[model samples]
Target: MSEAARHELPDLAAMAAFGARLAERLKVGDVIALEGGLGAGKTTLARGIIAALGYTSEVPSPTFTIIETYDAPPVRLPIVHADFYRLNDPAEVEEIGLDDYREGAAMIAEWPDHAGGFSHEAACLSILLETAKTGRIAIARGGGDWLGRMP
Candidate 1:
């Protein structure tokens, strides 16, 4: 494990800016595992990332849908946004064809712990968000390839 980088997001805008920075470093096969409690800005951060990728429309939370996908043109690359909050087991990932959806795309995974987590991957960037009095605190820990590329 590498040293985690800490970010202070004093407001929504700051969060979005951080998300955009992360977006600039995104690539195929990358897995961004967002960890946080409810209302910790996980979805908000994910939306910012998608928007920075060139998505002009509203980015909804995948809490109910479980998964949402964005392709190139509207975005620079394919992105799979998934919320695993409802999953009872990591094995459910196979049932939902998560691998198939990730075939050629990078993924933004919320509640990743429910799906076993992607921290083991060389391209995985695990961001843990904690609500603070002013806004939020983000502790980001990325794998080998992402160590020097963290946003």
Candidate 2:
């Protein structure tokens, strides 16, 4: 895709809008790997997607729990929200049955580096957040089929 056609989300609200838009296009077995620095609003974006799906409960960060499962109505599959920040090795991912989560569910993973090569061939979505004097800049990069649905 051309640079001019790329999506740019200026702030948290815009990011949320982007997330909501993405939610509309999601399907079971889809994987979204989120990459960003600390305090980059990764959880905020996840919250938007979850809330857009009609979930009313608090969407907590999976930083400690490693993963949180959400069951939103009207969808046949559950949404798995995972944070691999605390993982020290890729093998730890297997202990959690990450492969099982890969099937029949939509995954939103933060700090995905800990998952190592698991995201390979999966629709990889990268959200990079940069801070500026005026506000924050959010850039999205995706490969595979996500390129057409993003934004």
| lDDT (tens digit, per residue) of candidate 1 on 35-93 | 99989999999999999999999998899999999989889999999999999999999
How many residue pairs clash (N, CA or C atoms closer than 3 angstroms) in each of the candidate models, in the order given?
A: 0, 0
lDDT at position 116, candidate 1: 96
* Worst 10 contiguous positions by lDDT, candidate 2: 1-10
Deviation in Å, model 2, residue 12 alpha carbon: 3.0
Output the TM-score of candidate 2. Answer: 0.84
- How big is the positional error of residue 81 in model 1, measured in Å on the Cα after superposition? 0.2
Candidate 1 off by > 4 Å:
none
Please provide, for model 2 over 42-144, each residue's C-alpha lDDT reduced to its tens digit, 9 standing for 90 to 100.
7888888887776777889998999988875643357898999999998899899987876777888888887884345546565666555554566666656
Best by lDDT: 1
